[model samples]
Target: MALYDVLLALDPSPVVALNRAAAVAMRDGPEAGLALLEELAGARRLRDYHPYLLARADLLHRLGRLPEAAEAYRAALAAAGSEPERTHLRRRLAALAEAGHEV
Candidate 1:
């Protein structure tokens, strides 16, 4: 985590930021991770990055923030470059919807 912190300070690369966010989430909490992901979501460079959306969806799902998770999953589905990722995200979204949520 400290290594990622130093790397981010020097580079601030989005991938590094995402990795750090995952580290923070693991060390702090899903909420902390989701917060950093939310901040990263505002960056234009990540607008079409399905990985960001997928990360957010995963964290949100872990935190029981189902509505937001479903939305993020949908965004990831839309941006996914491959059919497999889209199919997986669709399954997750469908599971959420079946759980009595309007996903």
Candidate 2:
């Protein structure tokens, strides 16, 4: 199948968007992936999705938007329903704080 067709087929799937955003980040740049995440956030589609918020936080961190990245990580932690996920988010948050970020 064509790339566009495959993407279209997975358009309704959040996992697809998340992975696609990651791919875009790798292929184009963090800015492009961030744009997609922002769009998803604005739509309130992935507000409670840990991976979505995590991806946003990582992108913000890469862009040097440390404050926003911290916020995103916290949000992801809050929405994380699994203990392991919470632990991971906490680790990420701690790393950011240790980096002198105002988390």
Candidate 3:
């Protein structure tokens, strides 16, 4: 988190911001990380980035926001750059669907 903060001060790149948000989510809570992701969602550079959607999906999943997480996972799958990533996101989405509202 400290490294990401320093790098963010110097660069504020979308990728760095994404990592920082993940770290914050890990240390603080999923809501904190989701807030940062929300802030970055408007950035043109990350509008279609798979990582951003994936991160949001992960946080939502942790928070037990199943429907939102499932949607975000689908979006991440659509934006995924690699077949493996898409497959992983698909599995997550499928699991959520199988769980239904119980998740």
Candidate 4:
């Protein structure tokens, strides 16, 4: 944890932040991860990063923030260039919608 903190403070890269956020989520809870992702989203640094949005959306979905999750998934899909990634996002979106989510 201390190592992650040092790295985050020294580098502050989105990838580092994301890893730190994942660590926090595992150590703390989904809320912690969501908070970190929200901060990153506000910074607009991971707008074009598919994994970032997918992580945010997954966290939101798990937290029952379906509408926001759907939006995040859509954003991820829009930015996704690979067929596999787009298929995955579409599948998730479809699953959410099928589960009565407002996608």
lDDT of 3: 0.89
Instruction: State every prediction's TM-score relative to the real structure.
Output: 0.92, 0.83, 0.92, 0.88
Model 2 lDDT-worst window of ten: 1-10
What TM-score would you give candidate 3 relative to the actual structure?
A: 0.92
lDDT of 2 by residue, 1-103 (tens): 2473498585766667777778888778999999977767754667687788889989998999999999998998998889999999899889988999888
Which tens-of-lDDT digit does each residue in 32-71 have in candidate 4? Answer: 9989877887556777888887888888888888999999
For 1-103, candidate 1 gives per-residue lDDT tens digits of 8999899999998988998999999999999999998888778878889888888999999999899889889999999999999999999999998998878
Q: Sort the predicted structures by TM-score, highest score first.
A: 1, 3, 4, 2
**Which of the two candidates, 1 or 4, achieves a greater TM-score against the reference?**
1
In candidate 3, the residue pairs with backbone N, CA or C atoms under 3 Å apart (3 or more residues apart, or in different chains) clash, namely none
Error of 2 at 44 (Å): 3.6
Estimate every model's Cα lDDT from 0 to 1. Answer: 0.91, 0.83, 0.89, 0.87
Candidate 4 Cα errors over 4 Å, as ranges: none
Error of 4 at 80 (Å): 1.5
In terms of lDDT, which candidate is stronger, 1 or 2? Answer: 1
For 29-97, candidate 3 gives per-residue lDDT tens digits of 999999999999988888888889899999999999888888888889889999899889878977887
